[model samples]
Target: MDAFGDGNFEQSEIDPAAEFLAREQNALAGLEDEIPPLPTGPVDDDVTQPKAEDGNDDFSGYTVPKQVTEEPERIRKWREEQKTRLEEKDREEERKKEELREQARKELEDWYKHHEEAISKTKAANRESAKNAEKQFVAETDEIEPGTEWERIAKLCDFNPKTNKSSKDISRMRSIILQLKQNPISTNKKV
Candidate 1:
């Protein structure tokens, strides 16, 4: 506390933001006094300036200048809109594809249903035809009499001759009896 000056020099240091603002003000003041040189050659069309042919000093025909450091809000909004449009198109395409898949699935199921119905109808027709054939075969076989050449084999096989059309076993016996009637030599063989 016995020093010649106050020990508070560190607290008096200037803020960095204030120093920067002071420098920026001095630079702007210097630019105000000086005049910018006119471009010699043909100026680029993209710069924000009035047309030389119009000779007007107002802001007409002057496009807003773009900064190299920052993007405008309009471009960002346009980009978002484009992205949304593309996503919507993709969703629509996916929905169409799903619809096509559903249509194909329905068609396949219908085809299977029709095929099953056709198969059932064909099976019923086959059964009817088989029953008709069996009836025709039985009618043709009824012409063979009891005491004909069929009786000899029926006697050897211990079967009754009067009941030839009685049961399934008798029907099979009648078929064997008819085969024996055709082949005379096998009739003498024992069962």
Candidate 2:
């Protein structure tokens, strides 16, 4: 070696570089010893949250799932009440109609039994007999009067309003008289 005097680099010069590499490798190994080891198998996932036992809660006071409700029971009860009310109303209407019908039937029966004897009287439909009329209906009990009760009652009960002539109109007076003569009830009776 031209030693330090001349420009020659020998094995000794390269030895320091090798020593530096070895020291660095040892330091790295030491650092690795202090580090945690890598897992070789699947990590455990058995973590579980405990349920509230003593009923005590954490910071947010343990929010539970919200509950839902239905009002079908209430609605069903309301419907039942409404149905009962409606049924009662219908019954009342029927009772009123029945009362009116009975009164009419009694009046007719009395009239027929007394005046229209021997003949089985029948009913006819007439516009005059409509319950909604603004005027009081009157008729001759003994004679066949125009717009009278006997004729009106006969036509009112026996005739079909859909086809019969109007009682107020005079043109149908002949048909009304003829109709009374042809009536089975009047024909059957002596009067």
Candidate 3:
């Protein structure tokens, strides 16, 4: 406590360096007394002894037993059989997956065939209805006189403006007549 306090009061002086040196010397002297003395005779190399490597002497003299290092004949045969069974199982799984994929492909083809047939039937019905409507439109317009409003529209529908010949796009003429019939305009009325 006095080492860290203010220097206003007088305190006894203590030398930490001398005390640390004294402790280290006592520890060295104790270690010297516990150490064993070295032999003064000739060394022999015939006797087998364990050697310490990297300061680790726990497994220096240890040896693996022969029974633990080599497997028995029965266990070896069992391991080979297990490997063969696993290969066969993998081949069977792949075959099952291929069969499932083939079945799914066939089902998809059947669905597409049925759907195409239904679509073709619907398109044929629509074409038949359009042809019947065009015949009915021609029959109604044929009765109008040459100087009438319906007669002028029928004559215009008979020829293409750009080619001055018979029109090929009869659907467009039919749509125009359909629109005129749905909403008739009065020529004598004033806005």
Candidate 4:
């Protein structure tokens, strides 16, 4: 008979819940044959060979053996050696850094020495140029005529016309000349 009371029941029309339960029961039956029976008494704590109370066969326990808590001597020695090697490496790096710093200092000093030499040379050349200009001015003044304007200006500057040499106040004389040139007094004016 079919589920709905019609005599047309088909194997493909079976209930899915009943089919699932049948499959589960068959799987459980197969697992029962493959599974070993559990021990009836207290299991031994030994990992290598666990002894059951019934004395069936040798079996190893799942628990791991207790390890020694102390650190080994060889491992400690190796760690100390590694620490020393790292310290030595750090010292070597510091030494190299110091050497680099010293080298940079020397290079800077050399550059400064060259820079100072260049400045000194420029200063010496400028002094030489100034001296040459002064000598040229002296030569021109020495050839001045007795009654000329240049001779008059030289007398006003405290220069010895016969010796053709200026006094110690040559800077002051130059300043006076510069001022007279900038603002000249009329020669035809009556004082």
lDDT (Cα, tens digit) per residue for candidate 4, span 1-191: 55688787557778999999999998788887786765445544642344667886545433334454777999999999999999999999999999999999999999999999999999999999999978987887898653355445644464343454553436666666656655655565677
Worst 10 residues of 1 by lDDT: 59-68
TM-score for all predictions? 0.37, 0.23, 0.40, 0.36
- In order of lDDT, best first, we have 1, 4, 3, 2
Residue-level lDDT of model 3, residues 148-183, one tens digit each, is 564446545634456644635566776776566556
Give the Å error, residue 33, model 4: 49
Alpha carbon lDDT of residue 3, candidate 2?
56
How many steric overlaps are in each model, in order?
0, 15, 0, 0
- Candidate 2 lDDT over residue span 1-191, tens digit each: 55578675444645787999999998798787686654434433442333557765442322233345677998989999999999999999999999999999999999878765534232223343454343433333345554444555555454444555655545465566657656534333564
In model 3, what are the clashing residue pairs, if there are any? Answer: none
Q: Model 4 segments beyond 4 Å from truth?
A: 1-78, 140-188
Candidates 1 and 4 compared: the better one by TM-score is 1
Task: Rate residue 172 of model 1 by lDDT.
Answer: 73
Residue 133 Cα positional deviation in candidate 3, in Å, after optimal superposition: 2.3
True lDDT of residue 169, candidate 4: 39
In TM-score terms, which candidate is top? 3
Expressed as tens digits, the lDDT of each residue in 1-191 for candidate 1 is 73858776465588999999999998799786586555545446656665556686665443544456666899989999999999999999999999999999999999999999999999999999999978976775686554455554454464565655564556575676667666654344577
Model 3 / residue 113 / CA error / Å:
1.5
